[model samples]
Target: MYWFLLLMAGVFESAFAIGLKLSDGFSKPVPSLLTAIAIALSMLMMSLAMRGIPVATAYAVWVGIGVAGSLTLSYLFLKEPINSMQLISVALILFGVLGLKVTSTG
Candidate 1:
């Protein structure tokens, strides 16, 4: 259940990030509302996950997932640059997140 919640939180983190960009600096009302909702839901899910997950671990994973997802979305949808260096960096972040979970027995 905790892992499930954390994954959901990560997805919402991605959603909110895309929403933020779509909001166009919050000048668009619909996207702004979506951004608010996505951020709220992400936080809620993270809080729920925290009941069973350590703070540092969960946070690192959450941010890692967010950074990867958001950057990928930007590349695909927004036509942003996705150079090899950036891709490698995001992959490293994912590996680090997994490493944190795998290395810790606590």
Candidate 2:
């Protein structure tokens, strides 16, 4: 349950990131409001997951997911360029996140 919640939080983190970009520095009303909602939900989920997961592992995994998700979304929706190096980096982060989950007792 905690892991699931953590994953959700990470997804929401990416959503908020995209929302911020679409919000245009908060000039757009709908996107800005949605972004704020996403931020709140992401934090809430992360905080809930922390009750069961170790803080260090949870935080790292959350960040790793956020990075990977945001990068992917940017490449797909925003047509942002993705180089080989960036792909490799994202793969490494995913591997590290997997390693943490496998090693974690909780």
Candidate 3:
């Protein structure tokens, strides 16, 4: 359950990023409101996840998910280009997150 919350937090973080982009420096009211809500929800979910997960592991995993999710979403919807090197870097980050999950006590 905590892991699921962590995943949701990461997804929200991705949405926050996308929302921020769409918000245009908060000039667009609806997107700005969504960005604020996404960040709040992300933090809330991450805090919930920390109840059962080690802070270090949870944080790293959250960031990993956020980075990957944001990149994928940007590529698909925002037409952002991704390169091979960036993919390899993201892969390494994911492996590190996996290792942390495997080794963490909480």
**RMSD to truth, every model:** 1.2, 0.6, 0.9
lDDT digits (tens) for residues 1-106 of candidate 1: 8777887899899989999889999999999999999999999999998888899988998899899999988888989988899999999999998898787543
Using TM-score as the measure, which candidate wins? 2
lDDT against the true structure, each candidate: 0.90, 0.97, 0.94
Candidate 3 off by > 4 Å: none
lDDT of 3 by residue, 1-106 (tens): 8989998999999999999999999999999999999999999999999999989899999999999989999999899999999999999989998898889787
Candidate 2 segments whose C-alpha is farther than 4 A from its true place: none
Instruction: Give the clashing pairs for model 2.
Output: none
| lDDT, model 1 | 0.90
Give the Å shift of residue 71 in candidate 1.
0.8
Scored against the true structure, residue 84 in model 2 reaches a CA lDDT of: 99
